[model samples]
Target chain A: MPEKAQILDQLYELIQPFAKEPIEFGEQTDLIDEVGLDSMKIMDMVMQIEDHFDVSIPLNVLTDVRTIGDMAGQLQGLMKDD
Target chain B: MSELLNKFLPLEAKRSELVAIGGADPFHVVVERVVSATEAIVNGQQVIMAGTNNYLGLTFDPESVEASCAAVRDEGTGTTGSRMANGSYGAHLALERALADFYACPAAIVFSTGYIANLGILSTLTGSGDVILMDADCHASIYDGTRLGAAQVVRFRHNDAANLERRLQRLEDKAKRTLVVVEGIYSMLGDRAPLQEIVEVKNRYGASLLIDEAHSLGVLGDHGRGLAEELGVEDQVDFITGTFSKSLGSIGGYCVSRWAELEFMRYAMRPYIFTASSSPSLIASTRIALKKLNSGTVLRKQLWANAHQLYQGLAEMGLELGPQVSPVIAIRLPVSMEEAPGVWGELLSKGIYVNLVLPPATPDGGCLLRCSLSAAHSPEQIDRILAAFSDIKEKIAPEKSG
Candidate 1:
């Protein structure tokens, strides 16, 4: 698995375009509540992440994911399997 | 307000904003009277119906009407029980058999509606530890069905065969347990799935496949068997699900499979077992409609001709449309959501009725004026629909600079 810090850095770059306004974010920032990515945007971002990491992320994993840290953790686990 | 209802406040606000700017509320359109298959009275004006999805235009066929009336008289109204209990009327069995014969599949199961058919079949077929690899642009029913089951669902890019193959490769041995799902024609953009390519990928991975032909039935194929038949890939597809509400001009849905194991799903599917079966009249009318559709070569030809006419007309006017010519044509409106309802209202005022689709529901978050042609639309009606569109060209199309 890639380092958690590395995953967070990549996620920040990927999610910036979906945010309504530019604002600083970190691992604990809520992807939905703080960053304001709607469900559709979130799905689009997930597809990008899947392609970037060459991992197939099951949608079931995302339901439990809320924070940026949660997403990084999920991505780490998915990448480890690869 | 209850805490449970608080989640809907944002949606309510958005709707209120839409309603405020509307000449006609897209969500609250009421058909006061059904004048014909191609016309309806909406908001006290007679408008050409272009979004009903009644492809074959058998909604008012004399034979279907007579059959429905006769069935109502002979069998009364609703089936008071589920198909699992006492509701398996002779007509229900006949409809199922007719469907099986139509598809040349070994077994078929009917549900109360198309949504339930997807829910039942998808949820029941796969369980814990299994994975469902579905197209990202699949319908809400397909997504819900995946969520209802214990299957770990992964989505490939819409209509992208290579993406599907890569995912299958990633799954490795787990690919055997994956059920790949796709729709014949995606509902929003009216684009067809690359069925032949998808089938080849599924075959390579040994993954099972299910296709929802909800929009493509009676709109494609040499005999209207949908994309599978159109592309000569029927035998390769494992399951075919479709709706009677579209081409068949009735209500209900069915899933036909080449595998006899589908017969097992009849009892195992909760959506099928717990829900009451379709009314006898519905089954009777659907039976008649299916027969009409089966031999509807002339109707299919007319439907395609109309589709090409509208598609070409819209294209010539510089209006962006869905990927290809289809009976279901969606004109992407180069306008904001605030202005879209007004454009649809303009059409309604000009005696034309088409669906106004907005963000999230639309493929690219663009506004769409969706038109679905029917065999019943006459040349004059098509001309009128075209003319109405031309009148609003400035409002819908982006301004071109020379």
Candidate 2:
């Protein structure tokens, strides 16, 4: 798998525990809407992402993080910054 | 499908039966007044407030008010930043120390709100593999905190020690870091938890226990230390979390524990480290309120007297109350969602203000008009409240009788 695809898969796995339905790690899957992530659960997912990636995703990053693709992109950006 | 979302939505097909006047402020109505609030002129009516959580009646107490004013003068309007930056004041440390002494614990940490205190403590303390075995009726805060921790969350029947033990036994032997959570007094039903039985279960399982005393902080125990103290298991319980909003008549929460690791959680806990610390005036006022709460056994006696009076008065009216009565007395109503609004409207129209809880919030398809009595309430106020309930009974009885 490509690095971006790997990152997306990891995000999907982190959210899969809390998600009501099976999550697809592709485009068109909106993390908040399609996956049914409530505000509190989304926060928990964010904390998990931080620990998994070993990167502190700033609170501002959440504003743009609506889907798995967006999250992967943000993670990619953070990895580059490292 | 977003059916789950649709199910939880307050503004769905359920709207036709109940009118949604405004946005989500939980109370579902806007207030249009400011006054001296032993009794408030709410929405153009002089309403006797049996709903307010002003337990000790210290919100308008001369000493409390004066202490708050003095603190505001000494410290500015707001801390203006998180405790990590500019929020931690001398008052905050002093209040933490005072709480530690009050609970007779080694250390205590304060949070911005009661909800966040649970969120911070539970989320920070437990991790991915840990399990949190909680009472099914534990407050939303406790549930949210467990969710945040990503822990294996299992809930037992409310106040049932045997059920709690069964769930603990079901967990894997390696999951030894299990945390058990229970409330001192349930907010909706107004019933106390069986703390002694719960503590016994926790001890048997070798699990850590956290008791939230939000409702019972000043109402239970001789010194008002709370349920565990009342049950004589205070030392056995690992952690005690409570709020100043109820009896202390302020707006903050605290977690007290004998464990030294609790102190380190202040640095690591996101809710504690990220959010702005409590205001200096709130800290100072809470400190003062704690002193009064510890010293004033007379106030507690008056509170119970008022509670008993209201409880008996409501029962005499043939209204269905909960199994037990504490400071909070919930009048059980018919199960229909439609009946709740009418009862709530009638009570409000009769110049008595009480909380209206609907289906899912109340247990087993129950609806309740939850009335919380304060020590500040005079006998006359209590009499008037009973009169309003009596009038409500008269209005609703004929229709049911037919």
TM-score of chain B of each: 0.98, 0.92
Worst 10 residues of 1 chain B by lDDT: B15-24
lDDT per residue for candidate 1 within B39-111, as digits (tens), equals 9999888899999999999999999999999999999899898978875899999999999999999899989
Candidate no. 1 TM-score: 0.98
Return the DockQ of model 2: 0.03
Model 1 docking tier (incorrect/acceptable/medium/high): high
* Candidate 2 stretches greater than 4 Å from native: A1-82, B1-16, B20-27, B34-37, B172-175, B394-402
Q: After superposition, which runs of candidate 1 have C-alpha atoms over 4 Å from their true positions?
A: B1-3
**What TM-score would chain A of each candidate receive against the reference chain A?**
0.94, 0.87
- Model 1 per-residue lDDT at B321: 90
RMSD (CA, angstroms), candidate 2 = 9.8
CA error at residue B300 for candidate 2, angstroms: 0.7
Q: lDDT per model, in order?
A: 0.92, 0.80
